[model samples]
Target: MAAYTGPGRDTLSDVLDWAVVRGGAPSVAVQVQDGDGTWFDAAGTADAATGEARAPGERLHLGGISQAYTAATVLSLEAEGRLSLDDTVERWLPGALAGNGYDGSRVTVRHLLSHTSGLFSTGMALEVQRRYGTRAAFREHRYDVWRREDVLRLAVSEPPAGAPGERFWYSTGGYAFAAAIVEAATGNSFESEVDRAVVRPLGLTHTFVRHRADPGYWGPHPRLHSKMFFRDGVRPEDVTPDNWPSLLEDPALPPLDTTKANTSWAWGAANVVAPLDELIVFMDALITGDLLPEAQHRAMWATESTKGAHWLAHTAYGLGVYELTLSDGRTLRGCTGASTGAHALVLGTPDGRRTLAAHVANDYSGFPVFDRLLEAEFGAPGFAYDR
Candidate 1:
């Protein structure tokens, strides 16, 4: 009922502080809900220059986690008889994936949601990486707007990762096609569909689409930071997890403030923003069948193997969500999201009786802080935090 006033809630603050003080995050916020009640806490500075403490209410970027919402919207359309998961991308958007060794006729809606479509990630293209992947490139194109067609074109121009349904290949470009299919089927923008199916229905006041023209958060939020900036001749691929710890401590590349960058390049894939508590409610409603019908809800967790996805250890990909096997071997479902300067994770039990939501205001991927936090909440030994 009160912030940090529930069972096992007392230690969350320490974990958050550890993330900031030791894990190289500028700020971290976390919220948990269970039979004991709800608890909230935050640590580190929201604005490093001002030494402002992080607040539990700050709106944080959801990043790729937004794909879950988009996927839910697609499922809602299916529930309404507007489309089917088996429907080929070609069925709705003719010739959208016909070029560059792609055959949309074989790429189904399910393939896109489960990351088995084998489509190349436009966001990971060399051109995009050179333009916006690193801190130096980000500064150059911070305000540039990338149209949907422009982004998708880069995907098809590259060779496919493999045949459709061959294996897990994470791709934001695939979600772009999914969003286009949504519009093609409903004759409405993907954002509008999400509002109708998830946002408005759940009364999520803090959550909304991050428009291309809007280059910053609408209200109070942490000043996002990243250590992705490196000296010239350093490639994005060189920033590996093995070196990330040292990089975080590297004096030459102190965290760069990336708070004001445009997110239009990730529109349908990673554009939602919400505070931790609202995100918890959204994820809970999703798995608990509050936002979906029985059949669709069942379909949400019908997971596909993530063997080659290089995702979290002991995990599998599902429709708009992930099936994570914890240290104790208990399965939980949720999504992890990241962008230039923010990261978030939301996971809950199938019954929706327990949930954990966390946000870090630095752009490091798959940090150990989340693993420690999950262990504290679930009474587990630990999770496989390795990337």
Candidate 2:
């Protein structure tokens, strides 16, 4: 593990400066820490229509980043000897292996966290979801199961994309498979295991692995929200209320849906959601020796970074989180999230310096502004927004 002692700490006042300059109406919160002192700022509005500014410690989804937390719990269980990291699936869940090509035996814990476990398919954003933003909307209007077995079954019917560790691939389904492994090994659901191992110990009060509680609104056109994938923006459009391009051509060896005109499905890959502060605390725990024992923490970041859609300045992956070397040579281990009108980036040095930053809106304006906020806090010059 890299013990990073960050120098010349940045303050939250700098972040507020950038936010005041570039932030339009989107709500944003930023907190940056050094060894002794910390700086914090919350700006903009929480609700766009009402112009309600967000208070400190507001909630937002962490997206697939929760997988990193889930991965840690699985690894912890392995350390306790409840199950070996190399254990196979058939030994635990017998009949669950229906049509999926995933051999629980072949899919190791090492494979799951590092996204080496070649699961069935990369989940897709369905058409109904494209029209409706939130996962709740998907369930209300459409009948999508978004099950772990669905993709596992999809893989069971197919062949492995390649042998585990052959290359780098990002699949939430792989985490789903790993979650299943956790369930089979401990006889507890992934949600329960996470709540037990990670959330409770790390003291993440706002971290939620399950779905968000929806405010009841029966209008024909309700607000769309997605709890996964932050790409161009965290707009309702970015929520994949419809099919995304990457979801179409997955390596799961799809016997069907080879056609590009298919819909997206919810899977374990993109379900976890959380707030920015909780994410910051979780990252702090990973750095301060609350999450991993010590040796496991070292092992989690053992592999070298290869080609993937994303990587952090290219170090390695122990499990789910990416190891990124910052411009100042500090290792920032965390994830980026964009779902519906929400965006998240939780970053910190292994020593103690941490920053929890995020924005939530029903539009796309929040992203660039957040980037500019990061720039100001990180000592980068130039205002991000042209306006």
What lDDT tens digits, residue by residue, belong to model 1 across residues 142-231?
898978777667668678988999988788888888888888999987778888888998998888877667776677898888776545
Model 1 alpha-carbon drift over 4 Å, by segment: 234-252, 380-387
For model 2, the superposed segments whose C-alpha errors exceed 4 Å read 1-25, 94-103, 124-148, 154-161, 211-273, 306-315, 360-371, 379-387
Please give the lDDT score for candidate 1: 0.80
Clash list (residue pairs), candidate 1 = none
Encode model 2's per-residue lDDT on 101-212: one tens digit a residue: 4456566667767777664334332333343433334345443344556545543444555666665555655665677778778887777788888888877676656531
Per-prediction TM-score to the true structure, in the order listed: 0.92, 0.70
Pick out the ten consecutive residues of candidate 1 with the lowest summed lDDT: 240-249
TM-score of 1: 0.92
